[model samples]
Target chain A: MQRKKSRYIVSYSILLILICVFVLLSICIGSVTISWKEILNCVWGIEKERTYADIIFQIRLPRAVAACLLGGALALAGYLLQTFFHNPIAGPFVLGISSGAKLLVALTMVAFLERGVKLGSIGLIVAAFIGSMLCMGFVLLLSKVVTGMSMLIVSGVMISYICSAVTEFVVTFADDSNIVNLHHWSQGSFSGTTWSNVVCIGVVVGITFFYVFTLAKPLGAFQMGEVYAKNAGVNIKRFRVLLVLLSSLLSACVTAFAGPISFVGIAVPHLIKQLFQTAKPIVMIPACFLGGGVFCLFCDLLARTLFAPTELSVSTITAVFGAPIVIIIMIQGRKK
Target chain B: MEKKEYYFHAKGLKVGYKKKPLIENIEIPLKKGEILTLLGPNGAGKTTIIKSIIQQLEPLGGVMYLDGEDMFAMNRKTLAKRMSAVLTNPIDTEFMTVEDVVGTGRYPYTGKFGILEKEDKRVLKESMELVHIVDIAQKQFSEISDGQRQRVLLARALCQEPDLLILDEPTSYLDIRYKMEFLSVLQELSRQKQVTVILSLHELELAARVSDHIICVNQEGVKGFGTPEEIFSEGFISTLYGIKVGNYDEKSGDLELEAKKGKPEIFILAGNGTGSALFRKMQRKRIPFAVGVLWENDLDYPVAKALASEIITVPAFCRISEKKIEQAKQCMKRCGRVVTTLDLSILQDYGSTLRELYDFALQNQLVEEK
Candidate 1:
């Protein structure tokens, strides 16, 4: 017991140190270089004049914070969906929750541009939430008809494909500038994040995290399989629905604020499992939070630094890093 | 040791899907340290009753009590701590080790964080030892054989350290030997640990041999629930399966068919791990039969020992000796017909003996020439 506790503490501390380093790196390496001293001074409000420190503080800090929050939220959502559905491949994008949000955003943009109207971020967030909830509603309905996880995953993938087709049809008829913005948004980036959006994502992720944590015991019971979980005292229907709602909420929040960031939601939870050697959510949940934040921070750094002034999509970088890690882990598992 | 008493009591229990009861208004008392085998053919609602007792499927009409406490009111963790279960389907977990899989039984006691305490580890170790899978503790669960996997599942349930253990068709996929071994282990566990074990098994003979109490669920509701002798003798099983039970021999504890007259005296030329199931089938069908030329140490010796027949046998490993072959020919002469099990593993060099028997049968016109 003592050894286990010590190991946990050591892991938590190492993760904490890694998060700190990533945060510092996020603040340091951007389009404009700022010294560590200046970054600290700006954060502490010691500087009295408008300068590069102001730009870093105002623009990059909020973007980085938003990335961390969105990454953690998306990963947690993926973790919950995977456990609830008992499928390793179930995720926000695979299940069409993110695509649902994308469709809503795309429709809202086309409607606004067509009517010559300008909508605020809050309106977009609401549209995204409604879209995700509708998708969740459909998935939950299908879950009743479908008894198996693999079939449910296939159903979700089908829903995503349908949603993507609809979004493409909408984009072809929209204004060129609006289509460009929609295309860039669909690719997913942290460039549009501000303080208010960060706060909204943080609040939603915090609330959903607490709710999901309360479900840890039932989720662990679920890991044993559904019949055993039901015998073990879980009201399987209620717990499953609760998990779906929580996961959908988290996915919607991230997609609403940061657009549809792909691999982070699908791959971060699996990466955390590889790192921790266990899927017990108590460990994996927090590990996913830290690991996801670090991953997104690093990806964002690469997105900014790789081609200098030419910014790459953050999702592209994440997929490049995450796909190989998943394949390698899968190969190793197969070898064993 | 204190004599622990546990009684699973149901009052006016009704269970089914969609709130319309499949089996309703039923009550049964299951006692501790006893093996109660739920005996039924398919679609008899045995699974429903088991589910209701464990509170997996909600009781549509009534209440169940475990040790006088209301089962429905108990929290999931509390219920899990008291009752561990093994369902029919194998859980598909990709990466868990055998020990890790079994250790999950401690989830109820380990709190939400699921950190294993020293006591939890001790329980896990003891359970693995009890199930005799300690050697495979470090191996991945997917690497084991089906029988080994079943034992590992039993170990996992044992690790839960519950007062009552429930299993649904625990022997469905096992061969006969493993089936017997699995039931024997359950019997031992019930006796040694003072735990109440309730399982659904299709094998009536094995259930008769192992269970302390038999609950026979037929289409006509709960047919019977009592000791094996009381339940088996009540003709409930015969009615349940719609088969005759006259072959169920009481004295020898072996089933023997009442012989039919004017039929061929079919002497079974089988031995060495063959003829047991065929013997039972023939006996159940009331077909007259005999056996010969079996070695003393062959696997079929036990079945022959149980059957009321004349057997010619030589010393162990004395294959096809002269005296035994003569005895076989004499037995074939006395009988009007013959049947032989084609054991490819054995009797490959017995072609001459087979040809001799065939020629004799053809010469006497005892059987049509083939």
Candidate 2:
């Protein structure tokens, strides 16, 4: 057992190495493949005023960082929801929380565009947060009424559909010239990321991540479910509220920045657990952050490069990989 | 020796779901190093009272004191340090080994990060060993069988090093051997560690053997609470569970469903204790039987008293009375068949008056059930 657990050290190190390689790969290999020498020069401020420097600093760097942060946030959000619901496949997307945020963010965008007002990064995240919470509240209420895990997941799928339909309705009839932009954002790409947006995502998701880390102990207790968690001294009501808010904040951040990116939230944490061979939150929380970052960075690269000038949606790339894992998980769960 | 002071006490407790009380005016008390068993049928508010006392369900009205402190006034961590419970909640410890599962019992004592110290590890190891699950400690919880899983959970609760342990239907998934082993381990904990164990058990025989106190709960309330001796009197268990079809023999802790409620079809010459199983077999065969002349102190009395359609009796010391013999012969004539394990020749050689009754059965086509 000790020998097996030592593998966790190896897994963590491997995940860290993967994160580094993927971050660099995302930053260095964009449409115009800037040479390493030019990339080094731009980062080191040797050619600060050059176009190479502008592309590296203003565009790829912030976008890559946002993908890393928001992706980690999404996976951690999934982990929290999985723990909270005691369901392995429960995720922000699966529970329709991200779609909820998408619906509200789209509403906010349309409402602002009608008055010729632009929503800021903070404004978008706040709008998405409210939407995620609203959807989360509805799912929780459904959970109270439903007895089975399948029923809960089905209700969540229905919620995702309802939110997606409303977002489509808002997008189609909007008279703004930026309706094209609304359509693109709804497809969930990591493009249009700014340094300011990166900062907001960093502060919010970063703080929420740390808060989640603090909850690792109770979260571990929670794996045994509510009865044992209470016996283990967890203040369940307060802990439950914190769980909902933290998970909402994370998926809300992802939806605000990149639209409702799919599969990374549910799949990444599961992949990490398999890699580590243990679900101890002390290890899984950080592992999910790093794993989610690498996963999204890889998917985002595939999204941008696969169709070249006609970039595919990031979620389309993630769904291609993530949806299969979800299917496998369901099959395995049924077998169990 | 520990004095018999109450270690836990609950008074006037009202418990239910959604504040709609299912049971009311409950009171129970326990002493250190004693085992208490709760007995009730399904959905009799047994679990409700357990959950309520553990603070999982809010009591509509009550005050509970643990170790002389007002329980509701205590802090969660403090209460946790003193008490632990093994409930029926399903565990989803993904990839968690039994050791890792048991290590969770250290949560209340560990730092905010839930890192186990040497002491916590010591407690965890001792708990695993106590439950005889040390060999399986390295195995994943999901990989173990249901019985093993239950043992792991008990080990987890024991790892808390609590003064009081609560369990609900703890032995439900266990096989008979594991059931006895689990109860003995709890008994050892109670004796050696002075731990108080309060649990619900479905087996009345087992409950009678182990409990220092027994509580019977129903939808109405706590129907009865006392020593096992007090609780086992007369139709207490039957009335408490509202059993209509069966009879629960308090003395022997045997339950017998209403015997074929008609005239006797078979005459059973039950002697000594040889006919208890045959009595049950007759009952199962729907053959109402009249058993002859079993003394009150006889081993077969309890069972025969439960299932026999008619019993011919006489004072045990005196030889079977002529009047009782006549009565037995009359009842035997009514039976479609008379079966006896007794040999007429043996009874004649022993000069027992039962020979007369046996000879009377012989005239009526007596057949011995092997």
> What is every candidate's C-alpha DockQ against the true complex, given to 2 decimals?
0.31, 0.80
Model 2, which residues run further than 4 Å from truth? A41-49, A110-117, A172-176, B1-5, B261-265, B329-338, B342-351, B355-369
- Deviation in angstroms for B149 in model 1? 3.5
Clashes of 2: 0
- Residues B12-36, candidate 1: write the lDDT tens digits: 7777887767876676677778788
In candidate 2, list every pair of residues with a backbone clash: none
TM-score of chain A of each: 0.90, 0.97
True contacts kept of each: 0.42, 0.86
Query: Candidate 2 residues B152-251, lDDT tens each?
Result: 9999899888999999999999999999999999999999999999999999989998899999987677888999999999888888888889688999
Give the per-residue lDDT of model 2 (tens digit) for A27-62: 778787887787788767887558888788888888
Worst lDDT run of 10 residues, candidate 2 chain A, spans A40-49
> CA shift at A40, candidate 2, in angstroms?
4.0
